[model samples]
Target: AFTVDVKSVANKQIPCHPEQKMLDAFLRRGEWIPNSCNQGTCGTCKVKVLSGTVAHPPTPDSVLSYQEQEEGFVLTCQSVPTSDVVIAVPAADKPSSTGHLLRDMTATVLQMQTTATDTLTISVGIDEPLEFSAGQYVELAIPGTNDVRQYSMANPPSQSNVLEFHIRRQPGGLATDAWIFDSLTAGDAINLTGPWGDFVYDDDDDETGMILLAGGTGLAPLKSIALHALTVNPQREIHLYHGVRRSADLYDVEFWESLARNYSGVRYVPCVSREHWSGRTGYVGDAMLADFDSCRNYSGYLCGPPAMVDAGVKAFKRKRMSARRIRREKYTPAP
Candidate 1:
């Protein structure tokens, strides 16, 4: 047991212990941390380890580089303090009421469609309707594998009865490889958890244009928010950049194109990193930077692999975008 002294962005001090995970300890004491992937990949749970000796579990090198490890930065989800410590975390402006509403949900698979070789668009209907904002994710329990995984919903709150998820079958992922590829069928029941995440769009800020950045299945939550935005306010200008390695990997291309065609204010840009055929080559962030000259005035929302999200954030920062104007959900694979 060690003393963990947590400091908020405003420098407020909160006392905690090392016995519990940092996030659980903070939440138990009426504090909160922004998070999505509880794994070390999403940089969302990153905090400045002002002073402490923390023991980190062995993680993939791709998650955090040596430079980041050299700095006092640490992912709260993957670090355990060895002694008394002080750390700084982002301030919680409006702590979620949904935090108290966290509970387990048992849902039945309503439908499933293979959109790509390893990607599936699954729709699960909960036994009890859930009230969740866009950009939130639910943990699903794989029946036979006994492995639970988190996936973001691609359907918005307006689509109440159905929760849509874009699931990619990871090569060796225990849960996905087993359930998604082999066992999962329509009508199969799976357990789920609370709609977790704080990266949802600020619906009150209607004047701020939205810049959505997505990679691979990271398009899930962003699609939800985009659909919601179109449904509630069709006049809002939205620039969506979806990136993939190949053109074939670009799932739901026609859907997004149709949305853009239907909504005059919505602009959809597809970016491919490969050099094979001709469309748009290079990084997705570069594509956005090349096309949009007024990124500084736009509010950015990013959901994707940590690399893409980090790159997009850095690009926006270079364009004079403030930290307050960006919301991100880092999708890190579990190691």
Candidate 2:
């Protein structure tokens, strides 16, 4: 057995079995670690190895570049401690705010529909009530692969028994592809653990207008936030920009348009990147820039691929937006 000196903003020592992944070990001990895409592709699980040795399985080069690895950064999801290890994690923004609460849920698949070629709109209903703020996600573990995939909850907290997921079927995604295209059916029972993620709606900041950016399936969490905002404050003057490759790729466009029509304050803009697109044709970031000349006073929430999130953050910074005002969650493809 190995010992771990886990130091985050909390500064605590946690021990783990030598064979356990750092994240699993932390969760087992009731410690929270911010993570998505447990397959080591998303950088959300990044941590600094302050000391001691670790044995990390080979990870995709896209996950951590040469410079990051040289700097002693490792994906805790893929790293196993060989000896006592010391790690440093970024402090939680809200210390008192606990990360997503954990609970075992046996949900029955209520509805499943394909939104795009690879995206699915899956609705599941739990036997008991569950509460989670907008922009939180849950983990669905598949039996055979022992792989846990995280999908953001698309429904609002007010919808206690229903859980919605906008899942994109990765080419060989063990859990999602099987559930969406091939195997899962209505009435099927699936295990879920969640409401994970620190990205939540800020009800306190009512005066600050929100700029939401979504790319592909990243729209899941943003949808939840939009739904919640509509439910509470319908006149918030929020701007939502969703990016897709083709016009057909614009899943749930009618729903968004309906929201925009119903709520006079909400504006929905869809951007298409590929050809054969007559409507706003450009990258989502570019569309955002064209629509809003200045982001000086706005609060921005972005969720999507790492590339899109990274570019959006830089663009916002260039437009005089403060880092504190911009919140983002980057989704990394599973390796």
Candidate 3:
């Protein structure tokens, strides 16, 4: 066993087994560490090793670079300490509420709005009340099959028993194909488990600006974050960038525009990649750089395909945004 010291305002000492990952140790102690994809793919659990040696397998190049590895950066989800260690974890240092526990619940589809040709906005009424943060997700079990898919909630916490999601129809996707095209309809019942994930608003620092980046159906969670932020911190600077392929693919433009008008600090910028339009045209990464002078003072929340998230992270880093300040929730396919 080793003693792990997390250097923060109220420092904590955790007992860790040689074979256990640091995140597991902290979680066992009821200490929260912002993490997603415990398998080490997301890079959300990264912390600087102030004084320690840890052993870990090679991380994905997209998540951790050679330069980061050389700088004593370790993914807490993947690394096991070799000795008593001291590390700096920003999320651990910040004040956070007690975490939510996973729950099993049944829900009935309330409504389905066709947001775009390929995207559907779904609202479901939960059988039991659920309390979840804006950027969290749930594992949805598709009826008549063993397939289960994950989707982030698009509604605010105020809607306790009702949940909303933005789902995109995929050509061969098992769950999406059924939900969007064939079987799903209002009054259909589905089993789900969660209120999972930690991609939430950081009440820890209201002064820091918030930047939300979304792509395709990835806009679901970001929309929740933006709306919640508006209600909670009206004065906080929020920049939202939604990237899609074409003008027809864009949805909820009026909502964002109206939001910006009401909230002086909120700025909504939509980027289109494929076709030229009167609005911003290009990659979302390029649009972000073009829209803002610097990301050095902002806290970034990214949710999208891995490629889009990777590009945004690189751009944010180049603009001097610290890894600790950038929080990400990836929307990948369910296994």
lDDT minimum window of 10 residues, candidate 2: 92-101
- List candidate 1 stretches off by more than 4 Å: 1-33, 40-90, 95-100
Tens digit of per-residue lDDT, candidate 2, span 1-335? 77778766455877778888887677556577766566666677788899999999776668888888888889887889998999987664551233544577889999999888677899999988877778888888786776677889888888879999988877766776655567998888888877666677777666678899999998999988888877777788788999888887889988989988999988889998886677898878888887777899888889998899988888888777878888788888664
Residue ranges of candidate 2 with Cα displaced over 4 Å:
1-22, 25-30, 34-37, 41-92, 95-98, 176-179, 202-204
| Candidates' C-alpha lDDT | 0.78, 0.81, 0.82
Rank the candidate models, highest lDDT first. 3, 2, 1
Tens-place lDDT per residue, model 1, 199-285, is 786676567788899999999999998887777788888999999888888899889999989999899888889856567877778
In the order shown, what is each candidate's alpha-carbon RMSD?
5.1, 3.7, 6.1
TM-score of every prediction relative to native: 0.77, 0.80, 0.75
**lDDT per residue, candidate 3, 144-174, as tens digits?**
7866678889887777789998888887788
Give candidate 3 misplaced runs (Cα > 4 Å). Answer: 1-35, 38-95
Given candidate 3, what's the lDDT at residue 269? Answer: 90
